[model samples]
Target: MRVPVELDPDVDDEAPTGDTITVYDKRHYVTYLRLLDAKAEGADWKEVAQTVLHRDPVADEFRTRRCWQSHLQRAQWLSREGYRKILEQAVANKL
Candidate 1:
């Protein structure tokens, strides 16, 4: 059960179509985070919402410099059920 984290709208929903895989907000970010959490690594959570992932030149730049790190810090809260909790919520939400 993957928790469905809301993806940012400015992040674009066009789903990339190329060899270069650029993940937006909740797309692979959530899955990848779950993978890492399972292995005791890390993942970011805050920027999952579409609003946060905005691609607006100014907004993106601001998020890149300001929100990125803080969002990733959620990974530190990992625990036995932390990943499970996230997944459950994510799956329920669906990207």
Candidate 2:
């Protein structure tokens, strides 16, 4: 299930899981979680995280809040653009 990703410098994406998406950043952890809602469900958290985030180091601030786990509990709170970025990233990783 390993895949490769070629980052585009022009794209604003760069945040790791659990980190806050800056106004400038096109994607973030929350975005990915939202996309997973329709793409997968129940017990798919780990897979979605691994695939979208690739286990990138999450920020300490976000980690303290356990935001990723917390989001898993709620399960649906991302915006449309956020969701699109998640699917885009997932597709990018496949290339």
Compare the candidates by TM-score and give the number of the best one.
2
lDDT of each: 0.40, 0.42
Predict model 1's lDDT versus the native: 0.40
Candidate 1 residue spans exceeding 4 A from truth: 1-60, 79-95
State the lDDT of candidate 2 residue by residue for 1-95, as single tens digits: 33323332222223333433334234234444453553556545444444443432343434423544544433333443345655766698889
**Weakest ten-residue segment in model 2 by summed lDDT:** 4-13
Q: How many backbone clashes does candidate 1 have?
A: 16
RMSD of each: 12.1, 10.6
lDDT of 2 at 2: 34
lDDT of 2 at 95: 95
Pairs that collide, model 2: none
